[model samples]
Target: MRGTGLAGPGHRRGATPHRRTISILTLVGVCLLALSATQTASGEPAADTVDTGFAIPFAGAPGYERLAPTQVTGPDQLNQPLGQQAADEIAGQVGLNRADALSEEQYRDLVAGGGVGGSREAAEVIDACARILTNTNGRPLYSHVDGHPTPSVLASYGLYVNTSGLLESPANADAPTRQVNSLIAPGGFVGTWLRNNGATHTLIALYRSAYTVQAVYGFAAQQISGAAQLVTNTREGVSSEVGMSMAPPLWIVNFALLYILNPSLAAAMPAHWAPIPSAVADAIRSSATGQVPFSDYAPYFQ
Candidate 1:
C-alpha cells in the first residue's frame, strides 16, 4: 500500500504539483506561440475530432519478443527525475519562486506518483506541454485546439517555446525548411520511437511492486490492439475527408512498422502461452478497455 503519511499536498487525484525551477531558455512557449500563429494563418479551426480515434498505442500485434517483464509497470520509477527536470526547467524560465507552485517534498510526491495526469493541477502542467506541441493556429501536430492558444500561461511553469534557429528559411522554396518540415512530417513518431527503445525506459521507471508492474505492463500490451483498430478506422475517415486516394495514412504505417520493430514490445509476448496468470492478464485487458489510470495501482508499489 502507499505510505501512510500525509500523502503530500500535490497528491490530489488529477493535479501534479508545480516545481519552482525554470530552464535557462524559455523556448517551449515561444515555439508554441509560433506554431499557434502559423496554424491561425492556415485557417483550419481548432480540433473537434472524435475521441474514439485517440487510442492507447500498444493494443494488439505480433512479434513482441523483446519486452522485459519489468517494462509493464508504472512509469514513476523512470519518470520521476525527468518530471523534476521539467519542473525545474519551468521554474527557471518563468523566474517564479518555487513556493508558489511546488515545494521539494510535493514535487517528490508527484514524481513518485508515476505521472498519472488527470487532476486540475496536472492539467496546468500538461497544458504547457500541449502549447509547445501545437501550431500557431491552436492545433497540435495531431489535433486542433478549441480556445485561443495560451503560450503565456504556462511560462510560469517552465514551459517555453524554443524555435531558436528553426525560423531560418532554406536556400530555396522548392526545398523545404528542414526544421519546419520536420514537424509537418509525423506526429512525434521519432520521439515515440526513442521512447519505445530503451532510451526512455530509464526516465519512465517501473513500479517496484510485482502486481502493479504486471497490471501496468498488461495494459500496455493491449494498446497494440487499440492502435490497430484505430488504423483501420482512420483509414476510412481520411479517405472520405480529403478525397485523396493515397495509400494508407502515414500514421497506420508508422504504428504498424513500429509495432513490428519495437524489440522490447515484441518481447512482452502478450499471447496466451505466456506464463503469467490469466486473471492478472484479464485485469490489464479490463483496464485498457476502460482507460483506467495506472496510478490506481500505486499503493502496491514497493
Candidate 2:
C-alpha cells in the first residue's frame, strides 16, 4: 500500500497516469535484463525439464516459471541431515516440530488432502516443496555461509521472504521499517505468512502457496495437527496471476526506492532497505563501463 503511488525516479507525486505506466514498463524491462544478466554471469544451467511426476496446473502460465527451482550451488540445505538446527528454528517459528520429519507415506497422505482442484495440483505443491528442501545431491542446502546470510532459497520456489529489509539498518529507520520488523519478530512467517498487512495481495497469495507447502510437510512429519483444515485454507488462496500481474510492479517500486531515488529520500528508508551507498553505486557504474568485473561487488553478497 505504501508504494501504490510510486512510479520511478523523476516521477512527481501527481504525474500523469500515462507517464507512470511508461515508467513501470521501463522498469520491468530493466528487471528482466538484470535477471538475465545474473543468470548468464552465474552460468547457472537451464531449469530442469524433468517431469515432477506431478502436473503443475499453471506450469506454462506466465510467471509460473518463477516457481521452479533455480540452478544454484548448494540449494538443498533444508532437507538433508533430517533435523538441522536452522530448519528446526524455521519450523518452530512456523508452529512445527523439528524432530518430526515427514515420512514418505505421510507425505502422500498430506498431499492427498491438499484439495487443490485435483491430485495433480496437490502433487505439484509437494514436488515444489521437495525441491526446496532437498537438492540434486540428495542433501540439504545451507542457507548461510560463515556469518553471512543468503537470499531465501525458497524464493526460487515462489516464496519470497516476508522479512525483507528487517535485518537491515536503514539510515533513518523510518516507520515502515519498524512495521516490517514487528511483523517478522515472531518468525511465524519464516516459511510463509498467512496474513498480509503491508505487503501486496499478490505477495500474500505467493506466501499462501508456500505456507500450504510447509503445512503439508509439517502434517506428514506429525509436527502439526489439522492438516486437512490447513490445506483447505491454502487451496482457497492460490492464484495464477500473482507472479506476472502483481510482482513486477512491486519490484519496480522497490528498485526505485533502493537505487533510483535521490540519496536523501533513499536514506529515509530503513537501513536494510536503504539505497546502495554512493561508493558502491559508483563502483557498480565503473564495473558496468568495463573498468572492472561485476565480481567487484562480491563483497556485498557476503
Candidate 3:
C-alpha cells in the first residue's frame, strides 16, 4: 500500500492545506468577536475573547459642561448600589477609620449610630467596608478654599480649568470649546456631579466638619479629591492599609488637592507636560454621550 501520510485522493488541486486552516481561523475570530459584543458582562466570556475588544479602564477628563458646577448628572452616571447611601451614612459615623479596621461589631455599631444601613451580608460586607479614601494626613480630602477650582488643578486632568474657563477656556486659540462654551456661565457641577446626580456632595464633603466630610468622602472621594491620585486616604492614627486606595506613582500624579482647595497653590504648581485642553473637552463630551474616552494619558504626565 502507498504511504499513509501521502495526500488523499480528495485533496484539492490548487488550495494549500495551510490556506484552509487560515480561513477557518479568520472565520472563528469574527464569530467570537460578534458573540463577545452581544454578551452582557455577566456572561463572563473567556479572557481571550474579552481582551480582544475591551478598552483599559481608567479615569478620563470631566466634560466641559460638567466643569461648570451647575449641570446635573444624567442617569448613566449614577449607578451606585441602593445601599451606597446607607454605607456613606455609616461611614460618616465611623469618621475616618478604614472599614476593615473596625470589627464587624464596631462596623454595625457605627452603622447603628448613623441610624442607617445595618450589617451587610457576609459576602456583601467586603464592599460595604469599601469607602472613599483620604489624604496622608487623614483630614477631609475634598475641601475647597472657596471661590473655585484652580486652573492648574484642572489642567492635570487635561482641562486647563479656571474660574474664567469653568465652562470653557478663555481666548486660547488652541482650545476646542473656546468659542461656544467660553461665554456661557459654567452650569455643570464638578465632583460627583461629573459622575452622578448627587448635587452638593462636593460641598457636603468639603465644607462639612471632619466627621461629615469623612462620611461623604467614604461615599465618593475619588470623584472629589486629589484631582485623582496619590497620598491615599489615611489619617495619622489609622493603619497605613486601612483607607489608602489607588496609590498611583507620585512622580506622575501631581497633588491636585493642593490647588483644588487652595487655588493659590496653582501659582507654585510646576508644569509637567501641558494637558491638551481639546482632548480633555473631547473626553467630557464622550462621557456625556455614553462613549468611552481615550484615558491613556501616561505620556502627558510623563
TM-score of each: 0.16, 0.21, 0.18
Please write out the lDDT profile of model 1 over residues 1-302, one tens digit for every residue: 00000000112354332321121012223323433443322112223322322122221111111111112133332111123343333222222223233334433333233232213443333222223321212222221112222121111111111222111001111111112222212233222332443334311221111111222222222222321111121323531110000011111121122122221211121111111122322333354331212223212221
Badly placed stretches (over 4 Å) of model 2 are: 1-83, 98-104, 111-118, 136-302
How many steric overlaps are in each model, in order?
59, 9, 11
lDDT of 1 at 257: 20
Model 3 lDDT tens row, 1-302: 00000000122468676874564345435534553454332212224211111011111111111111111134221111213233333223222112213334433343343213232332122121111111111111121124433212222222222223232211122222121122111232122221232223333432222221121121122222222211222233431210012211111112122112222221222222122334443443344321221224223322
* Residues 1-302 of candidate 2: C-alpha lDDT, one tens digit per residue: 11211111123578786875565445445544543444322112234443321122212112322322222235243212222343333223222332232334433443454322224543443333333222212322233333445443222121111222211111011212112222222343311221222223323332222222221121121111111100110123431211110122222222222211121221222111112334433442333221222233335323
Report the number of the highest-lDDT candidate. Answer: 2
| Every candidate's lDDT | 0.21, 0.26, 0.23
Candidate 2, run of 10 with poorest lDDT? 224-233
Comparing 2 and 3 on lDDT, the stronger one: 2
Candidate 1: stretches off by over 4 Å: 1-35, 38-86, 90-284, 287-302
Supply the global lDDT for candidate 1: 0.21
